[model samples]
Target chain A: MKYTILFGARSYEHEISIVSAVVLKDILKERIQYFIFIDSKGDFYLIPQDKMNAKTFSTGGYEKYPKLQMTKGGFLQKSFLKEQFLGVEVMLNLIHGSEGEEGIISSLCEFYHIPYIGPRIEASVMSFSKELTKLYAQSRGVKMLPYHILDKQTRNIDSIPFEFPFIVKPLHLGSSIGIQIIRDKKEMNYNLDVAFEFDNKVLIEPFIGGIKEYNLAGCKVKKQGEEHWIFSMIEEPKKGELLDFNKKYLDFSRTEKTTQAEIDTKWTERMQMAFKALYHHCFEGALIRCDFFIHKDAIYLNEINPIPGSLAHYLFSDSFVSVLDALAQRLPIAHSPQVRYLFLSEIQYAKGK
Target chain B: MKYTILFGARSYEHEISIVSAVVLKDILKERIQYFIFIDSKGDFYLIPQDKMNAKTFSTGGYEKYPKLQMTKGGFLQKSFLKEQFLGVEVMLNLIHGSEGEEGIISSLCEFYHIPYIGPRIEASVMSFSKELTKLYAQSRGVKMLPYHILDKQTRNIDSIPFEFPFIVKPLHLGSSIGIQIIRDKKEMNYNLDVAFEFDNKVLIEPFIGGIKEYNLAGCKVKKQGEEHWIFSMIEEPKKGELLDFNKKYLDFSRTEKTTQAEIDTKWTERMQMAFKALYHHCFEGALIRCDFFIHKDAIYLNEINPIPGSLAHYLFSDSFVSVLDALAQRLPIAHSPQVRYLFLSEIQYAKGK
Candidate 1:
């Protein structure tokens, strides 16, 4: 089966997506048939194997490749003579933020009926917004840190439940681009202004100093008729006041192996249970990483990476192809709407009579 | 200001979408530059003005038209020699049910940077599933009928809170496609099976026999800098048991005047207020209809039609072009993620130094 590596959409993490795609080329190897890149301007390109390097994209060398067109089943690349189908039987969504996690690729894949390894539309939509993610977590009986969503129109800072020092994050961003630690009331407005520049809404929560954050990546695979989860070893990321954009850039671009965090077995089981509660029926086909904060001996969801950087493959030991194969066979089928139009035809028949 | 009318898709209401598109051709007249149809098979076609009729789609005559390819900014049509851009500045989403209301067109339009008149992804996601819609209503302080969601895995019927003669509806479907009223426990299993055939999840609500249902369609348009709503007259659709797919078939095909429903002005205001609460910050840039059931003097939200058939033009006397023009100008901007990779560059500079 032919696989397509889709990456680099109009996102803040566009460069990170390219890095992930470049890493995937080595991992996917001979199975990849097309390297589809969506530029920051939202144009599609079909990059050759040799042109998969970051320099090719950064230097504008990708312009030499044929521009791809999104058609029914898959993408089409046109030459001087005719159009050719990329024949992508399956797609691996590598774009991290924005279009990748915000339901564009998921919607396109679902509409085109192409089986892909990524969060479905509902999962993507629920996870894209921090406020919505909290709601989803609460709906699934998972604990989340108390937070308040403030938009551009929100004027009452007094309404916030959190006191003195708090953290403000752009509602729909990841990789900690517009996240800021607000120390006092004086810094509140300025930090909110900065966060609002990245997104229309911002999520504010109490800044818990020295909170232990653990990251776990996993996916659910169906075998025969039963489904089970395959979880990766949890890793505790190095942090300061927070892991800002600079620290995350190094984290996003890496493909190296890291040792698993040494944590208690009971905590591990508790975290995995929380992850399962959040993932189970909601995130069926996607490989997702969930960051949890252990504060006051309670696990609270920090955020969900619907398409984690580098697919979070460094954390897992299993072969991605086999897991994706198992998932693809059991993807949630789009509702088969009754297409008979029998009633309409019957009305027409009566009118003719 | 070229406009594209997008209709049809893999939906139960595919025929109704064609009817809606044909009705739009007359109302939109010369403003439309292209009539793009997504067939039941999910293929795209550029239907010419001459072939913009129900017969063209019903008899599969639309195949004679040029096949369209979705490109970066807009759709592209390939001829014998070369491909041509449709140059669509704005689009009106006319497809109903599945692909129309399920975030495909919304995601595509947002991804491609095309200004469109339809529900945005979050709004579509919230309203597409009946369970999510109820949650959204509760979150927004809007009243909704009490319901329980059941999946195929749900074994015990005793878990349901409602009594006999309860309503069973496919969670993700519209137009009453797989909705049934279980008169007793004997019919519950059979109805659940039928509803499950349409969707994996089913929403069960107490059937309020002879409930007075009203539909109100409206849109929020940004005038100058302030956003205000333009609401159509409230409508009372004829219902028998349930407005099944057949009754909705006739209802979906109409392009005529509908009289404003005669009801208490206070009740009408309450319903409109509820609609406002649901649409305000959520469903920006889209024209939507919300169905409400008035039971015992309290207004309860029934469902939201993200893309109402025929655009629900008959409910309003205002010019759609003007309203759409205002909406297109003020469509919610996609989050401009921090594109400057300044942090990454700074890290590289530090390492190089």
Candidate 2:
């Protein structure tokens, strides 16, 4: 069946999306007809994944490629794209950050009646904004650091109640684009200015010190009886002093120290509870990585990554489920029902008319 | 500039959007080259407003009419849509309810670098979801009716912690689509079932009896070298019973009542404070109408229409500024500096490459 991999968003994680899409193409190559959406200059191109091997899908090289245009001139005007993608079966979304995580694409997919692998629009929007996500999490009794939201016009940084050694980050940006750790009030202005460079709103949360960062990646799949089955978790031990953008991405030429930390039954149960709480709260579909900080023997959820790096295959590798098997299971579960409904609804409407 | 009036969404207010867009066409025609985005069979058609006039942009007739496919291929192809919306200078979003009010169109415009005349995406999403909006409002000390949220899996409606004569409404749907007044436990299941027809989640709020409904429409515009200026307030006097969807738009057809109502200075000041608070919290561009119920001396905010009916021009008609003047002021403010920055950044990155 024809399939498309949506990637390369107009977001800070656009480059990361390209990498994820490329890796996904390698895995899904034998199974489906895959294409990458490389967003450049606010335009999207349906480029073969093989072509993306030569250059990175970034804003710089975006305009160099030709893109599919939806024109008012009807099918005859842009029949090629219609012929190529209309025949396709499913969409594998590899987009991250802003619109990717905020349910715009999900809504569009719903409008189009296409089957996609990931959270629905409602869950996407709830998870995308840090403020909204935290609020929902708080309502669900999830322990989180106290945060003070600062808007663009916020003038008095000194008057902020949150003491220094606070985490300052954009409310909406992903991949740690405008995240800073302010050590003192003197550094607050600098950090706030830096955070404002990326977004209009900043979330200032009290830094949870004396904690080891843990990256727990797992896949939540729905079985026949409406039961959710969560796979074994993969824990990533935090390397060095802090896990900033470079450290998170291992971009600073540092060989990242990643180990599969053993989870006891008690901690495993706690992790499961957290996952279920988040899943029930509104997350759905495929693999999601939940980042947590353990301080004083308590696990506090940092944030949830709907679309994690490398599709977080390493987490499932040890459990004997290849990334391909997991993808196969997740994709069909995500796509089939939605696609059938679209066709059925169209037929019903046509008959009614 | 090449522009589009995106309306006729899969919203409860789909019909209202048609009226709003049709009326707005007259105001925007001279300055912008616009087309109406008619949603038919889950795809968007960029039809000229003139064509829409000949054939009403209703769901039934939309499929029969020729339309511009917004995507090159079917919905799954992200690249297909990336090409279609290119060069569209502005989008005047008139669609209300789920697709419009929930920030889907706003986020898409932001991702596609298309300027839109409405609230920012974050604010729109926050305001659209009744549960989240009320929670946010409550956090900010906004006066609202005591309510309980009921999810789809909620069993035993009689067990809810609310008194009789409560209003049950689908949490996200706008225009009071599935709103029902439940006088007692007998009506609980019927009301919930009716609300479930529109949405999966429902809100049960205490019905404010013997209260007059008011509509306060205001616009936020930025003048050169100054902060944003909010225009005068317009209050709709309660004519008959409770203000429902039919009563709202079909008010002209009902028994003729006073077209205008007197706004006491104290109430007007309170209304201004609410509007300003909303503006600071999330609202950015265009005009918005806030519905309120005055019970005795207390004012309870009902819901806010980000893109109110006819842009709430009826409210500005008798004010210091004419409806045309208000539109003129509002149109220019649609050119958001923050949005301009996003466009410029994309363009600059493209040029640099």
Candidate 3:
């Protein structure tokens, strides 16, 4: 039951990833055989800590940690470490945004023949592309907000079908980094420039009014050779007119605000069924989390978080340690790539690594 | 420039891939610096031949070639060889079908920081999933034949909206494998059973009648500082009611029987624009080839070949060797992952030797 814990990339979520990885390492400190931190520049480092807190990354002088090298054997090798977790039984991937979650980490693991927790490359890539998710989900009757795609090549703002107060989002960004509510003509160019800074492709959609957001986290649990999708108690977060990054993280943790609690059995049943349908549509993932907006009793999906922050550990009743252990063992089975598309080994690749 | 020519995989397209690789090896014999081959079981080998013919792979006993290892440096290294492709100026990838074309090879190259040809993982995975491709392309107004998706969980064909004389294709397969033309109610279950063998999900669509097929090859050619997509001579191949694998490869080369030649400049211009739109929507592929149906004077895409067989060399009057050399140089500049995602060092990880 060897484990390799990896996180902290150059993404905007770098700090959040650090916090999650350190907390996860503390929770599963005894079980982990290796802890590797990838810097914003994609450099691998051997963390020299037995226990970590939120401040460890900054205070611990992590830059002093020896830079590690990859071996032909697929192990991240260092001069001092006796166990590198090269051929570990599983990789507990805690990476959040960008390449970390966008199939790069999973692709690396797949290539090296190590089973990884959560989604595989195809699922990660699919989730990373929000428009693709909408198209696939809408086909299965998952209600979604009306949206239009805009890239660098897009010239006409007049062509946008949505009215003002529309939200413009960089297609590939995570969190609310480059999202802006364009209220009028004067606001259009500024928001477009802001979004263009983060991503080449952007998505513009009508901002739903009176939107109440609900977040649900779930896992694919395997038992007795059969699989079941088990969801946790849903949480509704109270938000400002818009949940900006500052409001999301600085004010308080999004987890603490429980504006709405408990999900209806029938609604949960319908959601699990839809998720299973999407899963069967060539995506492989586990411990899935989703955000939805309930406007006038009709649910519109905000996004699917394949690898949620803190792994959404708070949602499950099981101890976070137990969840990590079980996930390390079970995620691979649920993440199996079918022979449907000339099935080959996973290690897909680290995009924009 | 040092060149590494790679191909062959375990997928159903294994033999076709070998034929392609062998032919490519012969065409670029004088220029190739090294040759590598991957077997169906995902094994890699070093090939010594300076030149290879179409017959080489079956008679090559490539298994006898030295088993090679991938270095952390992204070089395909073997002890006996004078040098590995570590930091090769370029890699001419001619792999077809399976992991070879499905972004795995490209991922491997990407992880090693080598810019290989064809679509990146996002596009490859998108193209690999027919349902996803349809959803993405149809949104861009890419006229596609009406189709329905039927997964293993589907209980009844009676529920399908498509009528009889439907073509059932496994969602993930290529090269026409596990495809059946269901002409009647009696033929439905058999074809469903046939397709289910290849993929868990199947696409059922009414077989378009009088479907005249057109195949066009194009590349993401760079001229001046601006990039332009130039297409090859469009070829229309006569079909025997259906262009199954047998009709596609074994009977005769699909290239020879060109029933229609010369693409209307206007049609090619429209197709290129559609392709560029698809590309900007996060697809990164060069040397793109597409199959289409001209019905009612409208274009309908059947599939997009990211790495067309033999790189669709015959379609272009340019020398095949020169195309490979030029592609090796220009592909990387056009393959940047954009700026919004935290910029990380692209050399992420190389797992499992």
Best by DockQ: 1
Candidate that beats the other on TM-score, 2 or 3, i.e. the better one: 3
Task: Please give, for residues A1-353, the per-residue lDDT of candidate 2 as tens digits.
Answer: 44567776556766566666666565556555546464544456657555654243333544454465422211111344354333335666678776577776665555555566666766776778888778877767677677888887855576568766888888887778779999986887888899988777888888766676666766555456365555545575556555677555533122222456766667767766776777663565556778776667777788888777756655665442353344435443211111112322343465574
Q: Which candidate model has the greater lDDT, 1 or 3?
A: 1
- Evaluate residue B188 in candidate 3 and report its C-alpha lDDT on the 0 to 100 scale: 78
Q: What share of the true interface contacts does each candidate keep?
A: 0.44, 0.11, 0.08
Kindly indicate the candidate among 1 and 3 with the higher TM-score: 1
> Where does model 3 sit among the CAPRI classes?
incorrect
Structural similarity to truth (TM-score) of each candidate: 0.95, 0.82, 0.84
DockQ value for model 3: 0.19
TM-score of chain A of 1: 0.95
Poorest 10 consecutive residues by lDDT, candidate 1 chain A? A338-347
Candidate DockQ scores, in order: 0.50, 0.18, 0.19
Candidate 3 regions exceeding 4 Å error are A41-43, A48-85, A246-283, A319-353, B1-3, B51-73, B76-85, B153-155, B246-281, B319-353
TM-score of 3: 0.84
What would the per-residue lDDT of candidate 2 be over residues B169-263, giving only the tens digit for each residue? Answer: 88887767788999987877777888887766788888766677777877665467356655545566655555677666553222222355676
Tens digits of per-residue lDDT for model 3, B211-314: 77777776665567566666667777556778687555442222332333666877767666666666654444457678877778787888877777777776
- What TM-score number comes out for model 2? 0.82
The reply for model 1, stretches above 4 Å from the true place, is A318-325, A336-338, A350-353, B318-322, B336-353
Error of 3 at B202 (Å): 1.3
